[model samples]
Target: MKETELRYVLALLRVQGIGDIFAKKLIQHCGGAEAVFTADAAILHRIDGIGEIAIQRLKAPAVLEKADAELEYIRKHNIKVLYYQDDDYPERLKHCIDGPVLLFTAGKISFPEQKIISIVGTRQVTPYGTEFCKKLIADLAPLNPVIVSGFAYGVDIVAHQAAMEHQLQTIGVLAHGLNQTYPPAHRKYCPKMEENGGFVTEFWSSSNPDKENFVKRNRIVAGMSEATIVIESAGKGGSLITAGMANDYNRDVFAVPGRVTDKYSQGCNNLIKTQKANVLTDAADLVYMLNWDLAAEKCKPVQKQLFVALEEEEEKVYQYLNSKGKEVIDRIALECNLPIYKVASLLLKMELKGVIRPLPGKLFEAV
Candidate 1:
């Protein structure tokens, strides 16, 4: 965004009684952020939600002064600002009405046709949860999905570490400003994270990690991903809140089921019992549900492996594709007399074996 426009956006957010939704409404109704300030009072009053108080707040000179100071802080720190209307913003997050109007980022973070998933859980992570998180990320590494978390204790750090271990990009969504790290101990991980995936926040330099800020931050964790996975949680925790937010956003939510006797398993069990989340046994469940396996094939070169072994069902699909060439998955399933779910699993296996390749519009061919 241009410096002038950014200043207006910052000022717009600083105005009392205005938030992301209203700021966006104002920006759109008046053409742009600058226009919102310049719009005539008569025209502003004509808009639905614009009341007298809000219009009066828009005229505050201190708002622009604060914006200028914040803009300076942004520039001095080399922060990257992602405007909601810009293409560079997270596409999934763009759909969220309450998503930040301005997202401040650090490090080299890019969202290029990538599969992004957020993994969140309790701060008191059990050994079982840690192992599950590690194994999940390791298994899903081949598909190369971006791992997102709140950058808190336990499950959050574990997920971020696992992603880094697999050489996958991991993002840390913070409740506080970019100027400082919460929990302070996790400060060591910042440099490494920024090198690859980095940190993102809607908070300003003055903002602190207050209690309510985390609840607000949870929405971003849930909003930016294709799905949100809960490794473990107590009866009522932030991870459950994130799951709730994900459900509200109509995004897939998965919970790793544990023994009912376990203290941390209560939340996951409740979510499953209420049908708010799908039971996640392993990485395959997520891969299958999100159709990520089919999408993963596109990331690789279509080179046929010599003398590759295939399962009985896999051979059927392979034979059909070999003869028919590129075909939709549904057609391949019909021709091979295999179920669609089975076909999807086989296709992913075959792709891993370098026997078949995916095409645009969900078509596939024998490599």
Candidate 2:
């Protein structure tokens, strides 16, 4: 957004009583952020949920002063601002009712039809969790997913490092402003992450990484992604909060299942028991659940080979594919009397075994 328009929007948000949802309503009703302040009190009073107090707050001069100061900080630091109504805003987040009206971003961040997933868990990550988190990113590397995390220690940092190791774009969503890093130690990763992906936050330059800010920040981590994956968590933690937000947003959630006795596994187990998330064993579960276009971006299947062994279901799928010559996934599922998800998993396994190959438009054929 231009400086003049950004100043008005910032001022509108600076008003005490106006939240994101109401700010959006006000902007739409008044035609623009500048119009919201310039429109008559009588005009503003006509809109539903716009009380007299809010109208008066919009007229306050101090809000504009604050906005001007913030605008200066933005200009001085060269920060990129994403307006909610603009085409450049995070598309998934735009659907959220509480998404920020303006997002301050740093680094080379772009979201254009990319598969994004958030990996979150307890800050006190264990060896098992670390192993699973790293392997998951590495396995999914072939599809080139954007790995997003809070940029904290443990699972968050582990996910970021793994994504970098694989040379995939990785984003760190900050709970505080772009002016500083929270943990301080993570400052090292910022430069490298900015080269491909970068940091995002709704907080202003003056805002600090307070306790309450994290709870609010969880929504962004969940909102911007296609799915949220919990690598490991205790019975209660911030990861669960993000997972709940993901569920509320109607986005997919996945949890790595571990032993019932494991301390960090308790939260994931509970999530699965309550049917809040799918069981994520590996990348195949994600590929199946999201129904990603495997043919377009998936890892290449092994070269065709003879005498490859197949499981019972795999053999069944192979026979059907061989007889049909080529068939779409849904038709294969219907003919085989298997669930679509099961069929998808089986096809992936067959592809790995050199028995089948995936074609465009979800078509599959025996090799």
Q: Which residue runs of candidate 1 sit more than 4 Å off their true CA positions?
A: 294-367
Q: TM-scores of the models, in the given order?
A: 0.86, 0.90
Q: Which stretches of candidate 2 lie over 4 Å from their true place?
A: 297-324, 327-346, 349-356
Residue 136 lDDT in candidate 2 = 87
Worst 10 residues of 1 by lDDT: 293-302
How far in Å is the alpha carbon of 253 misplaced in model 1? 0.8
- Per residue, candidate 1 scores C-alpha lDDT tens digits across 1-367 of 8989999999999998899999999899999999999999999999888889988889989999999999999989989999998999999999999999999999889876789999999999999999999988877777888999999999999999999887789999999999999989999999989886999999999999999999999999999999999999999999999999999999999999999999999999999999999988776678778866454553534357788888899888988999999999889888998887778768876876778877777889988
Q: Write the per-residue lDDT of candidate 2 for residues 1-367, one digit (tens) a residue.
A: 7789999999998999898999999999999999999999999999999888888888889999999999999999999999999999999999999999999999888987879999999999999999999988877776788999999999999999999998888889998999999899999988998986899999999999999999999999999999999999999999999999999999999999999999999999999999999999888789888987655643433667789988888889899989989999889999999987788778876776667887777688988
Q: Model 2, poorest ten-residue lDDT window?
A: 293-302
lDDT per prediction?
0.91, 0.91
